[model samples]
Target: MKKIDNMTVTQIKEYVVTRQKEEYPNLIPMLKEDHRAAVKKIGQNLEKKTAARDQEVQRIEKMKSIESGYYDQGILNIGGIDEVGRGPLAGPVVTCVIILKPDSSRLYVNDSKKVAKKNRETLCEQLLEDAVDYAIGQVDCDVIDNLNILNATKKAMTDSLAKLSIKPDLLLIDALHIDTDIPQKAIVHGDATSYAIAAASIVAKVYRDNLMQIYHEEYPEYGFDHNMGYGTAEHIKALKKYGPTPIHRKSFIQNLGLK
Candidate 1:
């Protein structure tokens, strides 16, 4: 009913913020075209925000189910284990163990391979700050070559578990078995299915990716920065052109017939 056109920019914003949804239809007709568009957009944006918040709540609830499934019998110190770089022709196989709090639930946390690099880094930081306890270990190219990738990954995971300040009562492993005295469950694709495993994957991936970025400075020919030591076509070409660096896993390269 009033001349909204006469209102200042700040007044219009204030009015939009304060106005209820039911009042929008009446107020929209009185406003100019730009203001009307802004009103509709604001309503839509609000709806989207509400939907996203609800989805996040559901995700959090789903993650909590894993917590109850395994640790409901009063086992609070459950560690999730994961490793990265088994397929890489260069760099070490890094592993991480994360012990999340009993009441912890991070909806943003997911399988490291599923998350963006920047977001993975952010989540890794959050895990370090929030986890009850955490540790990382790496099996270098020398060790990987000596024991093979599978054994090397197991060793790295076990080493990570050993380093945890509060030793875990139960372990949730992301696919492979670790040689540890502690109890563990090897869940296929556990990183995607279990919240704790996902946290460990994020931590290990970010940590290992940083190591590859550093290696990029020394081995610029392999594009380690982008591939994170994975054996891509460019990397294979570089291997042929430049030959193997000290970090290159000899056993892995042997398969490429690039001796």
Candidate 2:
């Protein structure tokens, strides 16, 4: 049956399933704004679901049966370590060490940078419940200035490892080696390639983002709420207009003359 222009979007969707799309071109266009929006949302939902499924497949490919590999060698407590806030001009470097049970590995995990913020929060909660053990460490801007970002990040990573209740037999570090005396492997993109690292990355990212949100209230001038201290144009403009806040990294802001 030909779709009439007067049909509601609900009816239009039904007709679309039963008929070729070309038969109902005007039906959707004629829909009220709300109905048109609903139709658009349906399309968007399909794309999101497809993307999620593809991500799952890619994650499996990248992890490459890593969970089984650890188990085969009798390594039960495998930790993945990753950090965030290293590049921000302000705020502390945050690190997380996550040790996931083998069963928890199948959960959706990816590099914190790759996951959307809201989804990362959701994943963070799930990872926490699923993980065998986890710990978070933060080295604030003062410590960062003292030790430098590279060393500060390493220090935070080690701190996180030290706090874990269950000591990890093996460590999967993201692009940096540590002196913890624990055996460790550094993967160039460990967060994307390994479950533990990815989970840790999520924790660190969520933790730091929350900290910046709190900092936003203290120094509203820097636009910390929006830029999260990444030195965006808005943040830089505020820095020039208001000079430096206590949280600003002294060495990092040398060009801005915030001293």
Q: Residues 143-242, candidate 1, lDDT per residue (tens digit)? A: 9989999999999998887788898999989888767888888889888888888899999999899889999998898999998888899999999999
Query: What is the per-residue lDDT of model 2 for residues 115-200, given as tens digits with 9 covering 90 to 100?
Result: 88889999999888988899999998898899999999999999998898999999989899988988998989888887778888
Tell me the spans in candidate 1 whose CA falls farther than 4 Å from its real position: 1-35
TM-score of each candidate? Answer: 0.85, 0.79
Clashes of 2: 0
List residue ranges in candidate 2 displaced over 4 A. Answer: 1-55, 106-108
TM-score of 2: 0.79
Q: How far is candidate 2 from the true structure (C-alpha RMSD, Å)?
A: 7.3
Best by TM-score: 1
